[model samples]
Target: MSKSLLNHILLLVLLFIGIILSLSLGSVSIPFKEIIKSLLALSVENSTWDYIIVNYRLPKTITAILIGSGLAVSGLLMQTLFRNPLAGPYVLGLSSGASLGVAFLIMGAGLLSGILGEFIFSKWAIILAASGGSLLVMLAVLSTAQRVKDTMTLLIIGLMVASLTSAVVSVLAYFSNSDDLQLYIFWSFGSLGNLSWQEVGILASCWFIGLGFAIFCLKNLNALLLGENYAKSMGVELKSNRILIIVSTSILAGSATAFAGPIAFVGLAVPHLVRQLIPTNDHRILLPSVILGGAILMLICDVIAQLPGNENTLPINAVTSIFGAPVVIWLLLRKRKLNF
Candidate 1:
C-alpha cells in the first residue's frame, strides 16, 4: 500500500482503539470482558451491566463520534466555501447562535425538565426551544448568504449576528433566576453526557443527511477553490451550490450545538489536522479523513472530560479549547494566510 493509504488504515485502527478505551474508562469502570459480554447479551437478554453499557456508555460514545464527525465536516465545508482555512463553524458564530437559542429556552421559557434536565437542561421543552432558536439563526444566515456576493462579507455578517446573539444572551442571563443562570452556565460549558438515546438518534440522522449532502458537493467545492469566476467559467452554478453548502453546514453545526451545547475546536481544528495528514486539498479524500480525525479527537476529548482521577469532570468545551486553540493559532500563523 502507498504511505498515505497505510497512514489512513493506521488512523482507523487507532480510532477503533480510542472508541473501545472510551467505553471502558469512566467513573464506574467495567472490565473489557464484561463489556464484550454485555454487547453479546444486549439483544437477547437484559442485565444490569447491559443496561449500563447499552443505555449509558453506548449513547455517549455514539454521540462523541457523531458530533465529532458532523462538526469536522461542517468546518471543512465552511473553509472550502470561504477559501479561508480559519473559517470554522464556531468562528462564523453559528455555535454562538445556537447557544443564544438554548439560552432563551433555559432562561425565558423555563422548560428545564426531562432526560437532559436530570443532569443538565433536564427537559424536552428546553431542547425544542433550543432547536427552534438555532433553526431561526440558520434561516437568517442562509437568507444573508443569498443576498451577499462576497464570502468575506457573509463571514463578517455572521460574526455580527453572533455578537448580537451574545448580547441578547447576556441580557437574558442578567435578568434570569440564579438557578436558571447556573444551568445555562453549565450548558454553555458543553458535554456529550447530556444526550439520551433518542437525542443520539436525532443527531445521527441529521449527521448522516448532512454528510451525504457534503459528499455530493465535493466537485463543486473543488471548483470553488479555484475562485468564483473560475468556477462559473467551468459552468459551476455558484448560487445553488453555495446554498446547498450553507444549508448542509447549518444542519451539521446547528444540530451539534443544539445537542452538545457548542463543544469547541473539533469543527475548527480537525480539518486542518486531516489536511496536514493527507497533504492534499481534494475534498473527496479530505472529507472522509476529516470525519475520522474528528471522531478520534472527540473520543480523546471525551476521555479527558471524564478524568478518572478527579471527582468533578471537566467540561467538554474546556478540554477542546485546551487542545484546539493552539492548533488554530498555528494555522493562522502558517505561511499561506487564509484570504477570506
Candidate 2:
C-alpha cells in the first residue's frame, strides 16, 4: 500500500486504541470485557455500570473526538487561508472572544449580588454567550481582512485583538469575587466530562455545520495553497472564500470553546503534524488526516488527564499544551524556516 493509505490505516488503529483505553481505564477501571459487554448489551452487573459507560464515558469520549476534529480542521483552514504555518483558531482571537464572554457573564453575575447568577449560569446561556462573542470577533477580523491583503498584517491584527480581549478579561478577573474567579479559572482550564447528552447533541450539530462548510471550501483551499494571486488566477473567489472560512471557523472554534472551554494547541499542532506525516498539500487528503490525527491526540490527552487508577484528573488544556508545545518548538528548530 501507498504511504498515505498506510498512514490512514495507522491513524484509524491508534484512534480505536485510544477509544478503548478512554472507556476502560478511568478511576473505576471497568474491565475491557465488561466495557465491551456494556457497549454491546451482552450483560451488565447493574444499571449504575451502564450509566457510567453510557452517560459519562461515552459522552466525554464523543466530546473529545468532536472537539479535537473541529479545532484541528479549523486550524488547517486558517493556516491555508492566511498561508501562515502559525495561524490558528486562537490566532484570530476567536477563543479569546469566547473567554471574554464567559468572563463577562460569570464575573458580571458575581458582582450583581447573585440575582442573575442562576439565569446566566445556564448551559445554553453560556454556549450562546460564547458563540456570540466568537461571531463578533470573526466579523471584526473579516472586516479588517478586507482592508489588509498581507497575511502577516492580518496575523498582527488578530494578536492585537487577543491582547485587547485578554486585558478586559484580566480587569474582570481582578474585580470579581473569589468564587467567580475560581469558576472562570476552572472553565478556562478546559473540561470534556461536564457535557450531557443534550449538550453533546447541540455541539455535534454545530460541528457538522462547520465541517460541511469546510468541505464545500475544499477546492478553494487547495487552490489557495499556492498563494492568493495564483488562486485568483485559478478562479477562486477570494472575498467569498474568506467569508465562508470565517463563518466555518467561528462555529467550529466557538462551539468547542462553549462546551469544552478554550482547548489549546490541538488546533495549532495537529495540522502541522498531519502535514509532516502525510507530506501532502492537497486538502482532499489533508482534511481527513487532520480530523483523525486531532481525534487521536485528543483521546490520548483525555486519557492522560484522567490520571488512571486515581481520582484526580488534570486539566485537558494543560495536558495538550505540555504535549503540543514541545512538538511545535522541535518542528520550528528542525526546519529553520516556516513553509508559509
Candidate 3:
C-alpha cells in the first residue's frame, strides 16, 4: 500500500477514536460499550446514559465534525486562493461580517418584553443576523472579485471591510448596556454543545453544499498552486473560480460562525497540520486528509473543552486557540518555514 493511503487509514482510526472519546468522556462519563449500543440504536441498561449519549453527545460530536471539517476546508480554500501561508478562512472578512450582524442584534436590541422582543432576542435571530451579515459580505466580495484584476487587491478590500465592520461593532458596544455587552462577549467565546439536532441538520446541509463547490473546483485549486497564469493557461477561468472559492469559503466559515459563534483557529491550522502529515499538494489527497485531520482535531478540542467529568466546560474558541497556536508554532519552527 502507498504511504499516503496508510496515513489516510491512520487518520480515519484517529477520528473514530476521537469520536468515541468525545462521547464517553463528558461531564457525566458514558462507557464506550454503552456509547456503541446507543449509536446502534440498541437499548442501554442505563436510561440516563442512553438519553445523554443519544441526545447530547451524539449531536455535539456531529457538530464538532462538521465545524472542524468545514473550517479546515474553508481555510484550505483561502490559503490556496491567496497563495499565502497567513491567510485563513476569515481573511475575506466573513467572520467579521457575522460578528457585525450579531453585534447589532444584541447591542442594539430595542425590544424588551413583548413577543417581538422575545423573537428578536431569540437564538434564531442571532443566526439570521449572522447569516445576513455574511451574505452581504459575500455579495460584496463577489462583486469586487469580478471587477478587480489583482487578487491581492481583493484581499485588501476584504481586510478593509472587516476593519470597518469591527469599528461599527465597537461603536455599538460603547452605546450598549452591560448585560447586552456581556451576552455579545459570551457569544464570541463560541460553543459546540448548544446545537439542537435541527441546527445540526442545517449546519450539515451547509457543509455539504460548500464541500460540493470545493470538489467542483478541485482541479482549479491544484492548478492554482502553480500560479494563476498557469491555471489560466490550463483553461481555468480565474474570475469564476475565484467567485466560487469565495462563495464556498463564505458558506463554510459563515455557517460555522453563525451557528457556533466564530470558533477560532481550526480553519487556519488544520490544513497546515494535514499538509505536514500527508506531505502532498494534490487537492484530492489534501482535501480528504484535511477533512479527517480537522474533524479529529475538533473532536479532541471539544473533549478538552468539556474538561472530561468536570462540570466546568471551557469555551470552544479558547480551547482551539490556546492549544492550536503552540502546535502550529512548533511545526513551523521545526520545519523552519511553512510547507506551503
Candidate number with greatest TM-score:
3
Off by over 4 Å in 3: 111-115
Please provide, for model 2 over 268-329, each residue's C-alpha lDDT reduced to its tens digit, 9 standing for 90 to 100.
Answer: 88998887778888999999999999999899999999998899999999999997788767
The TM-score-based order of candidates, best leading, equals 3, 2, 1
TM-score for each candidate, following the candidate numbering: 0.90, 0.94, 0.97
Candidate 2 is scored at a TM of 0.94
lDDT against the true structure, each candidate: 0.82, 0.88, 0.91
Q: If both were scored by lDDT, which would come out higher, candidate 1 or candidate 2?
A: 2
Collision pairs in model 2? none
Residue 266, model 3, lDDT = 93
- Pitting candidate 1 against candidate 2, the one with the higher TM-score is 2
Summarize candidate 3's per-residue lDDT along 1-340 as a digit string, tens digits.
9999999999999999998888888888777888899899999989999989878999999999999999999999999999987788999889889999999888878653354557877889999999998889889989999999989999999999999999999999999999999999999999988788899999999999999999999989999999999999989999999999998998899999999988889998999999888898999999999999999999999989988768999999999999989998999899887778
List ranges where model 2 is wrong by over 4 Å.
111-117, 146-151, 328-340
List runs of model 1 lying over 4 Å from the truth: 42-46, 110-122, 327-340
